[model samples]
Target chain A: MKQAKYGLLLYIFLALPPVASLMESVMIVHMHMQLTLLVLSGFLMGTFFKQRFASFFNNWNQSGVPGVILAVVIWAYWMIPRIMDETLTMHSIEIFKYISLPFLVGVPLRDSWKKVSYTVKHILYIFMTINFIVMGWIYVAINQQICNNYLLVEQRTLGFGSFAFAACMIIYGFIWIFSERKEHQQSS
Target chain B: MEQTIKETIRYPKKLLGVNPNDAKVSLAYLSVAFISLLIGGLLGLVQGLERAGLIELPSWLNYYQVLTAHGLLLLVVFTATFTVGYQFANLSHSFGGLLPKVRTLAWVGFYLMIIGVGMVVTMIVLNEASVLYTFYPPLAAHPIFYVGLVFVVLGIWACCLGVFINYRHWRKNHPGQVTPLLAFFAMGVFVLWFFASIGVTIEVLTLIPWSMGLVETTNVMVARTLFWWFGHTLVNIWYLVATSAWYVIVPKIIGGRHFSDKLIRLVVILLVILNIPGGFHHQIIDPAISQSIKFLHVFMSLSIAVPSLMTAFAMFAVFERTGRKLGGKGWLGWLKKLPWGDVRFLAPMMAMLAFIPGGAGGIVNTSNQLNQVIHNTMWVVGHFHITVGISVVLTFFGICYWLVPYLSKRKLTPKMNKLGVIQTIIWTVGMMLMSTSMHIVGLMGDPRRTSDTTYGGHEVAASWIPYEMVFAIAATLLLIGVIIQVYAVFHMMFLSPKGQTEFPVAEPEEHAPVAPLWTERWGLWTVLLLAVIAMAYVVPIVDMIMNAPPGSPPIRTW
Candidate 1:
């Protein structure tokens, strides 16, 4: 119940003008914050949704595959260079971007992730890691303006941010694996 | 006598434990790639000769037409087809066997690609589409050319889908198991290809209608932007697959253990993510976009080098490890201890050596200030030749030397094997001469893509003559090398004596029963990927749409 309140607050914060503007102005922040942060909020929202509507989600996403796949697809759609552009220029897209990310992708991802098999969860994680690396590459490598509104330095900053994030994720994975192995050895 | 003949002719049920059907499918893909290689090689010779001013291209066959065919055949058709074939083999062998349905779908993709290549090649020959391989319009090709490219992309997508399905099925069946490294690499290649091709797909959809006069004009910058998006990723697609062979196959061939599995996975993951947006680096000189964006891309371009750098380090580590195990003592003794006589090792090893300079040259090309000095010059041409030409093409040649024998259930003849080593050496020497001269003359201000450099005997043209002569010599050596390679591959495929074939699988230094679970989580990684892409591209693409200049009608300069 406490988590649900925090989720609502986070959602409200993301919707605020100052935060939204900052995200839109800087390419890296938009990617690292507006986009990634929204998903994180949705994950929080999923915890709330699970607590409040346990039976509803369980019945709807028994295997969690559909919900997870939906999250992935929605996330992929936003990644398109064109869609990124639209979020700034078109009002409808901007609203949809905020709502869909938290409610649609974030909410569903959290709900499905619990129900998802160990194997499926691992696959999803790997896929996300690769996606981050690719996005960083695009941000840094492209010479032309990918986003008309943002400056070039912002794009490069975002590119570096992407690499840093990816590195952190990999390090986390390595530590996780090391710990898991050590536990297994001890148990055996 | 009848029994002996029957035994000799009978197809093996399993090649490298892969079903005969799967083997046949892989072989079919390779055969098409090889055929394209032959055609592309001949065209390259013609291009070199014509560029050197030694031979006149017939009036009917324009220089640009040949250049278009050469680039398309070698870079697009040959590299893609071979990578697909090689990946299929790797996946099947690694995973035990692919589903029959997956194999069938792959065949469908194979035929579609062939048909597409056939259509495009025919149009080029007929002089209906002389637009260079870049096909950046305002210079429009025939509608058929665009349609043909669409088919090729669709075919590749179809193949990717099959691989995806097979991978999913494997995951379902083997719960809690990590995917094999080679299979993981194949999946990465297709996924990257699928994403990278989206830019080209948009270009084709827009351009096809315009070429057919369904649209009266097309936005040139928009089209060029889309093409570059696809173009840069396309090169990485080639490099990634060859890198896979280097990581998985090369170490084993030299009797070295695999590099750290975690590190390799990290490298591949980095490559797939970083490879795409770097395409904008190619368009730095264009006035349609702002300099800030170009500057951003320059930074992104440098990041793409990370994977290749990782690869270089890992490759040397593997070699050093192997060399020391074989009793080499000094710092450079391992290099001498390597199997220099074996074409399988030598070709790719030499190719790796060439990439150091080639990759460095690429960094220079991407630099905003420096690019002005070399953009659209023969220097750019020389850079790619060392990369795609020597690094990628030579690596593929090495793969073929072993792959053909494995598929055919035959032994490469001793004489032909020796000749294969000779062939690689010839290629190395030829590329050095040609690329060196090309690089030197480019700094002297010779433009690329022009048929004639004379320009009514300008003073600069007189200075270029010596380099051109050297290029002619290099081209001749390269041609001889191509002939020898083709002969060796064909002879191995058909006439080599029947023998048992070996598939090299590296034994890891420290074997773990199962890979870390997080390495397999493709779903999460994919979501993150999209977000990053959105961050990189959304603003610029929207800006293009909102501020687009009026479309330009087609013009045929040729």
Candidate 2:
């Protein structure tokens, strides 16, 4: 956890300083390169780091079949830009996500019927908390603002829809935590 | 407590459980919603007549009024009715018995809502409250409209109260055991609407009253804020209850056990939290709020996709596993093996079908740049028709097919029995054609509210006339489907049976070929948890630093 935090902080520090000008273009490009690597690292951590962080990954795996798919999907969605051209329309990408969703969601439901253990659920909560905390900090640092598109006004924010949905998930998280605690107390 | 019929009438010794009651109440609410749908259908017929110039249309039943009534009635009232009923039904089962007082209150609440809807319809017909039913400023309706609306909100408040009481009762009775999945979701939506009601309640009780000259100095911004509070969360309430019903019904139809009950509960909780604060998404376009706030809202709105995605996953997984276990071979071959004739399977099945177009349209509607071209256009109408209209109405029909026999205690006559599935296919196919045409018409610069054939000084061309004609034709098909439903349900309910009825009890039947392994453990929670994380990553920051403060001045954009 500490190492992850440090790595993120270092990436932020390298990315934030506005030192580059026409004379320092190389350095600016280097900074961009480093920032990309950090995002990549986070993506990997959110996705494949389960192999190395067995306990954490196992706990996360327990969050639910849906959560596991979501984590993978999010990671994959973020990395799409890195791997693909920037010119692709968001609509098309959205379509891709839509098509992929049924398959991703369906895959996990086939194998098991066991309830996600409480310990894994909480561990997932912790991981999500970290991810959000990091993303929130990035949003703050970058001075996030809504685009000037007409849809922005009528639709709310581009990301707000997703965010609102996520908030509902958080509410679920707390409910689970409390329920698990109560169950533990009863058993004890 | 009310001893009126305590002695003479014998209440059943055993109350139905969450699953059965969930089916009953959901179907009952759906039954009502579909009946009300005929009203909307009648309105659509009028629209077709007016558009074709076949009959002179009333000024009050102009495009905007009809559209608003249709939108709010089907999405809000119908959705809310089904949600409230589902909540109570689940409660009845989860609590191990009915809370008679709460049950009675729910019934009264249902009647109150009916009265309110009746009043709204009357006002629309009489040309009394014809300002277009939206939460925007400078348009006012009749005092009766406002009063009737108050009754509507009060009815919802009553329903919410019933849910709370029932949930508390259940918690009291069942100490250590996990709450019923459906009941747990009901509680979540119940909590959501408790807060949801505050905003709309204030708007209906205070702002509209003041606007109607019943009071002075009502805050428009305040009213707008409040309406959206109820408005947006109301969608969540719909999704939550429907999803709960989906969880119960879908697995059963496909011959599958729930992969993870706990995960589904978690998803319900996520839906509640995510759906509430996200109401500000509607305010994104207004200059009254800051650009940053809009950005924040966008993020939250997008985060909602995660759990929705989770639902997609769980549903497919459940169906897949069911299919595989029921002696189905191969990966996708199970799709063919699943039962399609069962009415119970049709309800949740239709919801999945409607979800495809509805969810896609939702993304387009929410996109910042895309909104400019489509906002207030026929495209906007088409989008919601796909989302709210398709999902809710299809589910309504589906629930009917599932529960009519159970509730009516009679076999649907062969004709009546088959009507449900046929009507469903007709409605689904008809809506796709209608909505798709509407979207194309919108893109061709057809404004939504105008009642004339002229746009920007040019009459619609002969080529364009085909789409318009198609819209009317499709509406007729939809009406036929609705009529068939009404005919079938009324016949089944009134003429079917009075004594205990018996039918074949269905076992779990799988639809999808393979079930994902993780569903049992974390399927629902994982999707919901990620969604929450995504939203939390965005909302507070924007609320605090980016969006205008809550009481900021209003800025107008059409």
Candidate 3:
């Protein structure tokens, strides 16, 4: 049933670009409608079906191999265009593939994906930490390009937006790591 | 079902650590925050006077100085002190048994934040840092301003660390245990904050090097990108933590179990994930970003409305059930069962009332087309003050009043308590009036961050005269309410008779029934599912990194 919904939503969504050219005065309007519908679908699924979908993934959890595979496929798709000079909407295709890649991660790992076993938890944490470090580096290097030769120093060094988030995350990370250690100490 | 929940209960007498002196410390933060507001308020009055072309003060006490001080002192310093003080009280009760370090850390953090506030104010008065509270760049301020802000962040970081340590200690002592829903919400805020800080930290650390001329140059886009990473997300961090207090306090007061505890926490986790990426929605109008990128952020921003809507659904459900259990019938029954007369109940109720308008404004602003109409206008200010300023700030006050006594072992003076409720009611109503007026004028094309003057001549000026008058009237009412709240809380702490204090009561949970193990186990997985769903929108976006259009702006290697 969920599959049907996903299919229908995608069909209507993908059909819009072609549908848009038919309209003279409201071509942009048609394009907007197509785009907005996809967002609406995402919102409804996240809010209503999150539990069912997440549990389904957990039931099929297999150590993120599939996630890595999906990532490889998307990466290969990008590399093929670069290497072979294939004619394609590279940017559009990239976004579409990224949007679809989640099904790879979501479908096979339903109920069992997020088990609280210490190993799985640690892996997730490490993954997130690495992502942050990478993003942080990207952010730092891009300062000149983004800020126009203005260095990014200020009080509350992280700034209001990022500091609040990082502060929250740091607190969360500290709690998780610290608690894990404490539990280990007790068990030993 | 009843027996199941009862069986999981555990109340430890040893954790009933109540110190009377803590009340004084809590009061001190609130008092100082109020005093800051008072000063800011007077500055606002001057601004109001200046708006009418009636400048009683020297021309040197210019609009820029007042505007900068009003924003920096009132919003950052005052609001934070009040919120953090409430947090100290909450941590003492929520994790009193699980973690014990929060109270000590809170003391240190509170003082650090105060010092930070003092320094910022000094910079403001000295005309050294006039970039306003918003640290958006190319408009850098004095080095002392940055240093002071670091102290503030450090202070907040310490407070957050305190919460984390306590949570960890608690979870360690009780392995495999699911955290209480409220504590999870609080912890989620910490999680969001830690990551959110990274962006600003990048900006600050990177900028300082160049500002001090250590580096040749800094990237403006990168800095703004990082700033918004902090800017947009911090708004949610403030709201999420403050609202968690409401989630706990509201249900208890209404006399019911939370409608769906498992779901509420999931919403919170979703909020954390969705918030991080959605911030780019603010930068949609920037020329450097491609349409697809803006399109992506637009979708993400719109998607965020789900969690908020879910929250409303969940909260209203609890209220509905509470109404039915109280012997009321139908949709209206829920309204009847609510303890309307009780200040504890009324304050949060009013806070919720304010959220409705703010939420509507939020949805409109999140829409790409709609945002273009009101972005960077008084309308934006109206929307935020209604959402974060009123909803979150009021909730902070409600929680303080509700939980402080439990932690401090002293009842709030009854008269002062009454006064607090009255003040909140006035403040909430006044805020709506003011913000609504702001939206009207903003739509009429009034600009933000100005003293109401523009280059389009007096035609634009004439349209604003009535709105400005209405705004002044509303501001006066709001100021009175704010001052009343300060006086009431202070009176409860310092001037109230000490002999009437209530001793601590440690309720025995040994005989209480425990919630079934299966229920708790299921709850944990449900929460985990929430996390997974939260990331679905995000994890896919990672694909954007590898697939770029030919001749697009290339991502620089770090």
Candidate 4:
């Protein structure tokens, strides 16, 4: 319980202009720290709510499919270079980034991940993998600046990151399918 | 039917037989690796201090010479020897024992590697090979250096061949059973190493003759291209060996069951296929390669990160399952329940954590456009320090804690155990300081591989001095950690009280009788691996050869 409270306080503290400004000044930290840490803070807060909202979560995400989908959508939104740029330029978007990541994405992911079937989880992974590949292709292929604030080079670097992420997903899918098939063959 | 099931479940004691000769060989390899690590680490500190302008080099030891020694000893000697020794232990324990012939060959390989390392070191110390570890020619080394490196590669190949023979014998006896996970991982690493070495082998064989003045000139671009081909794959081999520890060894110490054996095998197979060809990412900025080939290489490099990502997910899942079983509740609760105090578990876990940023930096590195900004900068130095330095080296240290004791039949003293923990903490803190500063300074346009950052007191270079100062301090911390670790390892091997300890093996969550047959198809996988390599290299190599320039004769810059 204390951990949850501390997490919330930490989230609020990080949201302060001084801290946020310092973090967002650096390109790598903006992505790795400000954004990623925001999600982690949300995750920590979600643990306290798990018991309290058990019935509500179970009713909405019994199979965990909806929650997983929502979380993925939220995550995919943030991966966009344009969205990242908006956080720097627009104040409202920055606030949204702070609030939505934890409550909407991180919280729901925690609730739904356990409820989802292994098959469904893998299917979700495939979708995420494709998402990364497409994002990477867009980032690398486009010569024009995707983000108003970041340099063209920074945008392209983000593209490579997307490619790496997608690659990992595809590899995971390959391994998952192979392993499952082997199990089915032997069991039958 | 019941008896067959019982036999399957029974522990295979025959496979765990202890051989004094094998132990001696393993110890010898480890000793060399440690010695290399200590020397390499000191050289790194010297380089860091030089970069900061805090120290003057004695006339005998130039900056480039120290750089070459640092890169060669740590990246090649320490990593290669430790991996071979660690894998030998794994194979011997899992297979019961290596055949006497195989054991004899392994010793021969060990001696050959030692001889090779000695020659390379001698040349570097004599200022005969200041070309840096890349040995990117036109800046040539003494012929002995190239020959010595070739000897090292051949020695590793011989050791790998022994592992393959042992696996074949095991398969012949077990019939339908899947290769045990550790053995499977060991085989995958060796196979990958074998194929990857082909490019370097060609490069070295050609370079040796050229360096000896047997040939008038050498193709500089072609040599570099081939070196990158061997280079990236070599890093992956190091990564795979560390991953093997994460998969097979870490789980046991933490009381976690193995993730599905099939999944683990699949990851290994995927690595075997994707680990090569990605080397083009290193050459993306080079002039000779076409844009299309470079782009394709970027994709391939991106793809290789997949297996590593899979490892992260699978490892986390294993931890979650174990923690839940031990009464951990909530989303992040499992993290706390882990045996954080145990150096064996803590060190590797921390290494995995470091890989998140390290791996992310790798993506930035592979970006063709982005490479123009950060390439050959301190950022790259920071990137690899996290990836290969902290992640790979620290994990190997964790393995040694238990492995040394297991092989030596000696127990780690409480004092040494305390020091081991301190070593890991200090290493983590030191790397954080050094790499963070390096990354930031790199973005400020600080060049790497240069002895001095202050280019005639230019404003830009002057601004980087503070970061360089931070790096020097970090190096000091790292040196202290290295000393403690070396002392601990030495004491555990020689002075610690003797006791028997079992090689830890985690049971799978669920038992499956028949192993997956497709995973065992090594010949097919090898063919696939070669085909991918061809797709990546054949066009580029052909292009370079067709439009050949007059090769350059050796230049001795120092």
Candidate 5:
């Protein structure tokens, strides 16, 4: 409950016009820092929602597969260059981004995360890593601007930025798998 | 597990002292460290006197050459080697003994560093490289100088591997147990060191070709951004090392428990995460970086002050608690209970005190408007001199008073302790006179890194001369301080009375909560470190590369 207050504060601050505009003005910040922070806010705020609608989550997110799929689909949609550009131009899409990312992506992801088994969690991580690699290459390799809102240079910056994120994910995966093996060996 | 650790220390091979083989490695590194101090300290004196116009250098020896050697020797060699020595000793003592291969890796690192340092020194002496420690581009060094730096980075990486291996081995063997606090600090230091060097390694790799004329030109902005990526983090690395001693050793010397173990580990985690991005403030005044980005990075730089303030808060609380327990009465009476005469306590105590102004100056340097006033001025020089010279170097000096004796199986005799107290006083007085004058004169418009700023004997310039003379006199005092410190160290290493000296590590308070298991999850911490670095650097670095000015060819300003 106390965490909800902090999350609400973060969400409100990020929602302020100046803050939103400043983050959106930079292409990399829009995709990486700002969006990730938004997801984090909702992840924090999810506890309240989970308690209030405990039965709803438990029924819909049984085995977590359905909720995980919905969250993944929303994230994959947001990764589109056309969708990102549309969010800047269309007021409805902008509002949708704010609401959907937090509730649909973040809150659902949180509810599903605890319900998912070990193999499911790892498979999801592997999926994100592979997805980032393909998207990163497209962003870097494409000749024309993919997002009308940003310049080609910014598009390229986003591409490179995506590559860095993917690199981080890969590194994380390596550490996770490596440490697990070491632990398993010790247990054996 | 705790009882086992205590018993391990109580009945060691040399009667509760460091193993003899491990002691050799630490001693070899410490000897090189002090020898570096001796040469670097003398160079500092000569450079100061020459800059002050009190002495003239021979034609064969130039001021920039001297400055470059002095900076490299003291800032890089002295600090790096000393940290490896002290931290390895801590790791060995905490772990009971180093794994056999870990010791080999340490010696490999030692030899690599020696070979690298030897090449760097020879080039500087031959007048082939006069680029100072920062070695910012457009003014390039000899190709081999960069190569030497590569070797140095490799040596550090080797040691990083050694520590990681030994740490993992410990964790595997003793499941579900937290690492000893001292080893935790060593982990923080090396992790920061390894990541920090990656930037400089990239920078140096680029420079090797540029200096060799294989590459016609290189982006100066990109090069500088990369150097400071390592440069500022390197400062924090030393700061982290100093704080390790403060958090762990200082409390023991004063006969008190350390601050909360959890908070101390959190401090280490926070320092590693927030450190690298703080380097952006060093380029606050540089063009091409947008004002909005600089504005944001100011907070990034100042965020480091959180952990520092925590340390200050924790240390004072420990002092008060210890003092009151020792029978002090009122609010301020606890101050009297502290050991004023013990060199081990007095030197680092002065260091923590020096950081008051030293850290304040750092905040000033981070502020955008304030930085404009002091950027590239002698005030910047004064800032590092106080921060690194007194705050960092003084702590290293303090560590030597015990560490040298403990490793050597020799005692810190009362006579040697008194001499150490005297040495600390002289060093403090010298650094104070030097840095204060520099700060004052810099505000009056004196530039740094210049051999002469007399402006053909102008009146305002002449006012700075008095300050330069203070620098000279202070340098002389400091050289004497250096001599006594070196002599004290070698005496303890070889000539002091043979006896066991305790390797002091402060215990935790009774009934303390178990430090959370999450603190040991360094794999997660390392990922967060990289992610934060990517976020801080991506936009600005991409801008520097994409919208760059024409690259500059290597120039020999000398």
Candidate 6:
């Protein structure tokens, strides 16, 4: 409940015109910081939905595979350069970005994260790291601007940001397997 | 209500007592630290006198040369050696003893650092490296000077490895147990040390090539950015070292229980994560970095204050709680119950007091508009003089009164304790006079880092002369203070009566909850630390590289 309340506050703050404009002004900030934070906000708000509609999640996400797939698919769709441009040009598409990133992608992630098994979680980590690296390589290597809204330099910045994200995922995954899970094994 | 030290400490006897081999390691480092303090203090006095127009230097001994030596010796050698010495001592005491390999590594580090310092000092003496401690680019030093710095960083890396190994070994051996507070601090200190040096090491390695003419030119903005990443975090490293004393040692000296263990660990974790991004605050007045980025950085810079504020609150709470326990009454009456007469308590107490002004000045320096007024001015010098000179150095001084005696298996005599109290007062007064004058003159538009204060008879520069004189006089007094402190350390080490001196680590109150196991998650913290560093740095760094100005060739302004 507390998390849900804070997440609502975060959602409102991110939706504020000043914040949205400021974050969107920078290409990497829009893709990396703002979009990631929106997902985070939804993940927090998922606590409320989980409690309020427990039976639906239990029925639909018992093994967590369906929810994980839905979240990854939605996230992958948004990562396409064309869709990112569409959000800027069309008001309806922009609204859909704000709605679907949280409800469609983030909410599913929150629900599936704990329900998934160890092997499934490990595979997810590998996929995300590889995905980010491949995206980063594309963004950096391309001489032309990939997006209608952003400059070539901004595109390169975004590319570096993706590599950073990839590196972080790799480190976290290694640590998770090596050390973090030991606590779980012992405590459980 | 008097509690015995033995009754308070629940650790095994072997762990509580000083191990002789470990004592040798700590003592060797401390000796080097004090020797650097003496040399650095003298250089500071000479620089002060030169700045005051009292003495013209002989041709070979330039003010900038002395200034370079002074800054490196004290800021780098003195602070670093003292921290390693003290932390290794803490690790030894808390862990029962250092691993044999770790001890060997400490010796290896010592020799490497001495060699580095030797090369650096020789360069300064030859007037080949008049570059100030920051070593800003375009001002090239001798190739050997940068090589010397490389050796120093490698030395530090060796010590960092030693700590990591010891800590890992401890964790493996003592499964499911919380690491002792002091050992935890050692881990945090070295973790920051190792990561912080990465940026500087990169800077120095590239600099070697540039200085050697192998590279045609180097990015000035990129170089400065890299330097500050290490530089700003180094400031926090000293602060963290002082906190180890304030949190663990001060409580026992004042006869009180330590603060909540969880909170202490949280503060450590926060400082480590939030610190590297704070390099931007140092570059606020520099060009090429956009205002929007600077605006974003304000949040990162000030986030460190959260842990700082937490520390202030925690220290006060510990004092008030202890003072009350000692039967003091009313709100502020608890203050009098503190051990004001004890040098171990008195020196650090004054150090903590100085931080009120020091921390406030730091805030001013962090703000964009405020920094524009005082950037590269004498106020920046004053700000650090108060923060590092008093807040950090005084605490280190406080640690010495007991730590030296403890290492030597000697007791601190009542007379020597009085001398320490006197030394603390002299230092406090000297720094207060110097820093206050520096701040006032800085606000009057006096620039720093130059010997020629009168500025060819300009009116504003003439007005600063009186302050400069005051600064010189204060420096002289500080020299006297330094001599007394050095004498005291030696006396405690050798001349004092041979007796056991206990290492004072405060126990937590019995009723306090067991600190959570989550606090031991260093891997998670390390990952987050990298992620945060990447988040803050990657964008601007990329921007700098892609849109860099024509890189500057090595220039010798001298």
Among these predicted structures, which one has the highest DockQ?
6
| Model-by-model DockQ, in order | 0.06, 0.13, 0.07, 0.02, 0.52, 0.71
lDDT of 6 by residue, B1-558 (tens): 335543323222453235677888888899999999999999999999999999999987788899999999999999999999999999989888787788899989988998898899899889999999999798999999998998889889989999998887777666677899999999899999998999999999889989999999999999999999999999999999999999999999999999999999999999888899899999998898989989999999999999999999999999999999999899899999999989999999899999989999989999999999999899999999999999999999999999999999999999999999999999999999999999989998889998896767989889999999999999999999999999999999989999988789999998998788788888888888898888898888999999999999998877
What CAPRI grade goes to candidate 1? incorrect
Model with the higher DockQ, candidate 4 or 5: 5
What are the per-residue Cα lDDT tens digits for candidate 3 across B248-277? Answer: 767777676654555666677677767776
**TM-score on alpha carbons, each prediction:** 0.77, 0.68, 0.72, 0.74, 0.96, 0.97
Instruction: Residues B371-392, candidate 2: write the lDDT tens digits.
Output: 6677767887677666665676
Pick the winner on TM-score between candidates 1 and 3. Answer: 1
Off by over 4 Å in 4: A1-188, B1-17, B511-515
- Which pairs clash inside model 4? A168-B306, B15-B96
- How accurate locally, in lDDT, is each candidate? 0.82, 0.58, 0.59, 0.83, 0.90, 0.90
Q: What would the TM-score be for candidate 1 when compared with the true structure?
A: 0.77
Q: Model 4: iRMSD?
A: 9.8
Better of 4 and 5 by TM-score: 5
Q: How good is the docking of model 2, by CAPRI class?
A: incorrect
Tell me the spans in candidate 6 whose CA falls farther than 4 Å from its real position. Answer: B1-18
Q: In candidate 3, how many Å is residue A47 off?
A: 22
Model 2, span A1-188: residue lDDT tens: 55445544543454343521211122211222332344443432332333355574456446465555464455445432222222123557434433333223222321112345546555555665555444434333433232222122222322343335445556656755655345445546
- How well is each residue in B20-96 modelled by candidate 1, as lDDT tens digits? 67778878888888888788888988988898899999899989999999999988999888998889988888767
Q: After superposition, how far is residue A180 of candidate 6 from its true place, in Å?
A: 3.4
Q: Which stretches of candidate 5 lie over 4 Å from their true place?
A: A180-188, B1-18
